[model samples]
Target chain A: MTEERRPFVSARTVAERAGVSRSAVSRTFTDGASVSEETRRKVLEAAGELGYHVNHLARGLRERSNIVCLVVADMTTPIRARLIDVLTRKLQAAGKVTMVINTGTDEQSVASAMRQTLNYRADATVFLSGTPSAKLIETSLANGQQVVLINRDDPLTGCHNLGVDNEMAGREAFFLLRRAGCTRLALVTSTAHTASLIERERVFVAVAEAAGLPVAVMAAGPTTYASGYESARRLFGRSDGPDGVFCVTDLLALGFMDAARHEFGLTLPDQLCLVGFDDIEEGAWESYKLTTFAQPFAEMGDHVVDLLAAPVPVIPGRRIFQPVPIWRKSIRASAL
Target chain B: MTEERRPFVSARTVAERAGVSRSAVSRTFTDGASVSEETRRKVLEAAGELGYHVNHLARGLRERSNIVCLVVADMTTPIRARLIDVLTRKLQAAGKVTMVINTGTDEQSVASAMRQTLNYRADATVFLSGTPSAKLIETSLANGQQVVLINRDDPLTGCHNLGVDNEMAGREAFFLLRRAGCTRLALVTSTAHTASLIERERVFVAVAEAAGLPVAVMAAGPTTYASGYESARRLFGRSDGPDGVFCVTDLLALGFMDAARHEFGLTLPDQLCLVGFDDIEEGAWESYKLTTFAQPFAEMGDHVVDLLAAPVPVIPGRRIFQPVPIWRKSIRASAL
Candidate 1:
């Protein structure tokens, strides 16, 4: 549908003017294809005179448009920045030119992003770490463009969803802290809630209650370094502060660790235990040595590309990946 | 030249079919222009029937192109990531769609990026950090595109250059550490050198030598957290370890601080005083409270836009910003 609309100059016109066969013109343009210099020169001269420009989109007109749109909201976040770089490299290696759109997670911004995608006539769109409005997804599906949502669990029909198992990760974190001999457990999160963070917190609380362990919850202003630091002070201000804490994100966990050590002078693992999710690169720094659940970035990139290459009319499908626990020095060594 | 090559639909054709003046057709497309509803309806109908797609470039063929190309080499660096985000927002607000080209500092990649800028017929191009090859800059200048380089000091003729005053920043950092009663000093930097880091290091060495204070320099790998941690250990391995240290970047400083405290059991400010460049957010955490220099991101973004909007044949200009020192708990509190 997108390709047929472009104005193109047929190769036949160049061949006729150059006084050569159509196959000869193709040979001239094809790399490593044998074509006499004289014939190639004539074809090139004629094509240039006729203003014949190559339409890369026309070659894949029947099956694909060779263009992918990457939609992301926050590029400053460490994980999102890493994902964008990796995904862009992978898509470029696959011979697809990526068109990135930075949009807020609001309904109006998502609608605008969808309009931009339609204007570019993209063959596929990847929503990275934000819930795009359902209407936009349906509209994209209706236009024959595949839509893949990352780190989201939307049940929209005809869309592909991929995310880490946040519930299972939360349960594992609780058990690990408990086994490490932490009696008082707490959870820290930000106000600008993402679905994945919400799920991680909800499941963690549920598991602690099921085990009959008391829990405390603290809400930070935003998932930023400053917010986490301030929230940690508030948590430690209590007379009976929790000994074990799980932060919904690594940025928050880093803040909590710093405050616990520098401000409160608490000994880690011996006096307190910490766990974080989305194991960013900074988490492994010798200072933090944060124990976190590592999300599979390489696998996610491959899955997105594979889904796009699949035949159209893809039914709504869900693929969940188990998060791997990366134990470092943040938690005490424990045997199950 | 690019506009002449594109297939365009003239307003004359729409005017003739709608039986209206060509000026009326122009007024219909112009925003907030007073055109009768009946005439607008007729003009739009004629345009739709004739398949007339509005060419924004054609409208400004004599002056500017609505496209701006942003060429960056490193996307993972926190400061660069923040700059890209802020620049994109500012460009979008000014009604220009940015075309981002991620390239390496190598000659081949830089040349390829220049070709892409020419293909898009961008009005201007902004180089974030890496030094663009001289040939590419000259070629872009010849093609009538304005070129701006950030964090660079190359005397490239007819190219605008903007950077922070690294010499002054380095000198100030040296004095601040000295006032904290530090007798021995050291500087930590990465192997993958940038011009800004080089300038900072050069100035610090010059100042210390003039003050008759010996300085030690340690090089790290890639300026990552791990590299900083390793470099700190190497600095401590010697019996003559320095009491004060300055890292060329904030990321490295964070790592060094963490290692000094967590691994070496050294108390900050009492055992060692630290300063960093590019005051990143993580530096302000309660654990680090690093004293560092802050780059002016918002001002730089505005300056780039202003330079691009300047009249062509713009005489090359140089703009330098002063780096502000943000003091925190990383150093001893001073009345001054």
Candidate 2:
């Protein structure tokens, strides 16, 4: 099956010239390995004279090529909005053409996109969302593909995971509300089954309960402003309505705020305290100045690219992060 | 040079079975050309069995492959954010790689990036920019490379041009201000020196002057929020200064609003009217429902891909445009 395709200066040719084995040729190019400087120099001189370049493709899984597949849930979501652009450019600068796979919010579709990336022979893959099944992940790894999860949890124990600390971000938001003097705090919840949203909710409830204070949480179907708008009625219908509400995302917070202000005619910072996570650009606009926490997107993006291109998997374990709180006009402190 | 490039479809290849001449085969396939239904069916059946497909590339160079380069100026800019992701997906969807060229800001860097794209064997290239060029455009038709200014203005005639209509957009802002009853108006400008800003300036001036109203326009250097923050002194410096200010971009508008409200302690929408362009996500935030206009980015992206995929040269003096006005809460209506 190995057809004599395009004949070029390859690893075998390099191995012969360097008076070394094919694996030795690969080891020389690898980031770190014990190769004496004298021997390295000899190999370099022979390669330079012969106009031979190391075939990175033959190296162990990672060094083959810089090609990385960018798998995103949606093209226009505010969360992954800027990260995708920065990551793509950064990868391209490293001589990698990002095989962008747009998986429109379906896990199955994400898996199919992953299959296409594998078939196209990508060196590494970055999943923006949707946890790849362990079996497929193992298959891809078996075929020598590196996988990195961006702003998400790593389903595989040893995979590179890069994202913000959602639990601490949630706790910080709760305190911001508590500092605002609203004690009857409520968590604006969603049953969308996303890891990020789930982590935030867990933290918000844990922080409240740990302080020996009663905390309330309500789950609404899916997550969107439209959903939050509907949740306002259901949450308020309860006997013990909330004086403060914390949404998992800024969009949902805006929906909740709109429901309280425009719908219920409840003047903001007077009747209820509201806050959100993921300080999207829109959160600071005149109408929303939504006090929210932000996961450092630009830094996270650069880290993702670097980790995927790193010499070795430097950071181990599932990365847990805390988003920095961006104090804007939305919360109106003293409501906790 | 004119090797028969694998004939699009051969009549003889089909005729050997049809028992007819090449002329008979041509008549059968040509539209409105005389051919009996029986013969037509026979010819089509032969074509199907042979697995023949029509080639759309050669008609008027329609079949000739024309490589397109898609260039972007800073991905961090909100206007260009998520744009590359969409463009790449769309371009690849059309079976084109769109040799992406990333250029630095300032005219010289952008030109170098354009040249790099040209070096990649691009027949036509598109530049996605906010600033228009100051240097006279260079044209080399012999090379078959056409310069397409995407989302920017064209200085030279016969150059491909496409962008948002800033004039009508300006008028929309004017009407919003007029309705808000702001008699005194000022425009916060940037020194980005782009064609987009120039056109917006032109439209705003035309609308304001034609309305026979008192309006003051101030131009400032630097395009970021911090830049506008530094220029806040000028806004309050002038006696009988503007009661309403329209900024060239949402970022500038945010800075101006911050300066007017937080620093100067002026109530917004009452003491000053603010309008910005791009209708960026930030514009919809709680603090600055910036009444502004937006370009249909996705539609523009789709069109750019479509135009580049088709190899046929466009008719001279032809252009396509679509501009929209997005109304938010920043500018008050009839409150002067």
Interface RMSD of each: 8.6, 12.5
Which stretches in model 1 have alpha-carbon errors above 4 Å? Answer: A1-36, A39-67, A309-316, B1-35, B39-65, B309-315
Across B146-216, the per-residue lDDT of candidate 1 in tens digits comes to 78888877778778898999999889989988898888899999997778888899999889989999889
What is the fnat of candidate 1? 0.21
Clashes of 1: 0
What is the lDDT of every predicted structure here? 0.78, 0.66
Q: TM-score of chain B only, all predictions? A: 0.86, 0.73
For every candidate in turn, the CA RMSD to the true structure comes to: 7.1, 12.2
Best-fitting candidate, measured by DockQ? 1
What is the DockQ score of candidate 2, to 2 decimals? 0.07
Give the winner by lDDT: 1
